[model samples]
Target: MTIGQWYNEAHRALRTASTAMGRSRALAAADINAAVIARSAIYTQLARATALLVGGSPAAEAPDRARATAILARHGQSLTQLYVGLQAAAVVERQFPASPATAVAGPARSLRRAVDAVGVIGDILASHVPPGQTPRTPEGLAVRAGGGVQSGLADIARLTSAAIMIDIALPGWLDQRRGHLTEIYRPAAEAARWTANSRLSAVARELIALGRGQPRLHGLDVARPPLNPAPPVSTADDAVAAVSAARTWMWQNPSELTSVHLQLGTQLGLAVHVLSSTGDPTMIGGWRQAAIAAADLRATSPVGPARDTAAELTEVLRWLRSIGKGNHGEPAGRHLQQVSRLNSELPIMAATLHKGLSAALQRRDLFVKDEGVLQRPAGSLVFRAAERWRPAMRDDDVVQDLVRALVQGQDADSRSEHRSPSSRAFPLPPRPRTPVSGAHWAGFDPPSGPAVRRSR
Candidate 1:
């Protein structure tokens, strides 16, 4: 070939390679996105199925099963479409000489968008049923009328696995925002510590009682005047003595009444978390009453830190209630308002528990903003659960584990004490490459030449 012709051919080949690489990158991005979307659809279906099957099985059988099946069929169609799109993208990606460089940014964005969209869909599905029939109480009319319990749970397990897949990929996106969170958490933690300590102290003093049934003027040793002029007697000291007696009574007599302190503490803690996150203060009054009840238990006993703190906690809670009503300036900081409102809603049985927990979360929110080593180990547990569920496609044990992890993080002193999953066995059929679809569905794509595989 002539020199000029050879040079032209080289330039042509280079241009072709660049074009091919760009296409490869685009396809890879699409494949990642498609996989996420498919998984989301599957997760949604499985959740619906499980809810219907488990929650409704006892109430209604035939209609419920039929309804659950129908729902699954529609979801199956969406899954098929997602798989087809991903497979096509994957095939395209494999043909290019150099895989596209744009994949780094594109895949992350696609994955996030897909998962978020599924969340919206889940919300919509939830709405189609009724309110208050969430994971906590799934046996509502819709579930009972639509499917059997076994199938419902099976579906739930399926979708939960799918959602985890997306959530698993979220940490990288969150890492960029870690620095901005530090400034927000520090002040909050300081305020929480100050608040919890002050409350505990107040409780101790109120229950103190001293004078009741005292030995009548026991003969005093008159040998010498006490140095530093024995500290003046105070009502606070008297209150402490009285409360101590009450404490003695409870410890001595187990048969008289049930010791519900620990149980009450747990209830109070949950109430506080619910109230704080939801930003409502109406609940604190009940908690105030609970603190009083606790205080009342030791009304005739000597005062100690626990009693004093309990009293202090009540006073702090009262103050919080007042602030929630109008004591604070208009439009307090959002977090403060939330904390206040949560304090307001305290049930009568859980005041101390709520107070302690609210204080703890508040401290953590402010003091530990580094996305600490704790967060990683915790996240790793979640990731591992997700991984375990991927191939098995089982949702129940995985979802249970996820919830357990969340609870552990919130309640445990140290995240280092990781709890293993309660059940190691997953109950689900192996994943099928081509999910079955129904006639009414519109999104299914015929299988592509190359198969697409979802990442574990």
Candidate 2:
């Protein structure tokens, strides 16, 4: 038979097998690996056929040459589809590491990488030939073939190399995260229950010392200052001390405070203390501490950044619970509600903050009065408070937002002291809008049955 005809037959077999595999027929998977093997063998034959055809072999006598070339092209397309299926399957498999043995052993699952590499080579080979030209040499004269095989080999090598890199990197990361989830964090959480009731002051001191070496765990120190201190201290210094301690503790032993409750308690406790201090910088720092504290709470929560921030705002609610409208008036209510609104809108606020920060950096201007504030200036403030800051940008954003809320909340509290109820009720400026989908064809009306009156 002619080379083209043989390739056609091979192509037909592969197509049928692929269809069966798609339907997830057991018979197809059972023998799918064998089908790929057979397909690979046919590809080798096709390569040989092309070589023979290029060597001026007779059209009728050396039909295998023509058949191999055509078959290789068809097979290349089929294997491309096979590679796609394998990649999709791999993605599923990644999500379910303990998949059934049959899944692990299936042809689409196992030979996916190999099929993809080989398929890439086949595509290169297929493209080299002209559509109607007999793969056999013209006029029975032989010609030397070069580049086609080399190009295919190069493509196969590159794809195979990339596949190997993905295989190596993905598993290592997953294994590490799994180990943390299964072995480290889970056990620590169980142990934390026993430690929660320990002397808040003593625990605070040890956590502070532990935090000194690690700046991020600043909030964990339980000796954190009181929510509101008297005239002598100003409360802001105490808040800074609490933030410092908590930041250090959380940074070093983030594993300890895995739940939202712990995160909020740590943050608000620090905020209240910082707000009590007399110093301006310390008071401002208290605001930052509040924001950071809230962020830390969110970062540790199970609901991801969006829900975690909302959950973290429960700390603000806790703080409010302690001192309701005591001479602060409805302005306090408005401010608290604003904070609640921010907490509810954490995800969007977080995004806006990021964009604003980026814009500020680009504009080459400072948003705050102190350049040192923008620079993350150091002090015993965080060192003496609770713990150090947590790792990751999401954590920072949460803390920053809490700080903003505290600062703004205080401003609202002070401003409400002077403004009457009527002035405060006018709707505040609207926040930036978030994107949501709308129907493109919502307002469109379909044309009538026929343009009957068009022609006069």
Model 1, 1-456: lDDT tens per residue? 211232233233323322333343323434434433433343343333333333321222222222333433342233322222222211211121222335434443433343444344334334323333432111122233332222323222333333333333322222223454333233322322222222212211221122122211111001111122122222222222222222222222212222133223333334343334442232233233333332212112213433432343333334334434544465423434335222211221121222222222222211111111323354355422221111111122221222222222222311112111100011111111332111111221123221122233
Give stretches of model 2 more than 4 Å off. Answer: 1-253, 258-270, 273-282, 289-321, 327-456
Q: Write down the lDDT of every candidate, Cα atoms only.
A: 0.28, 0.30
* 185: Cα error in model 2, Å: 59
lDDT of 1: 0.28
The estimated TM-scores of all candidates read 0.23, 0.16
What stretches of model 1 exceed 4 Å from their correct place?
Answer: 1-26, 29-108, 116-289, 296-336, 343-456
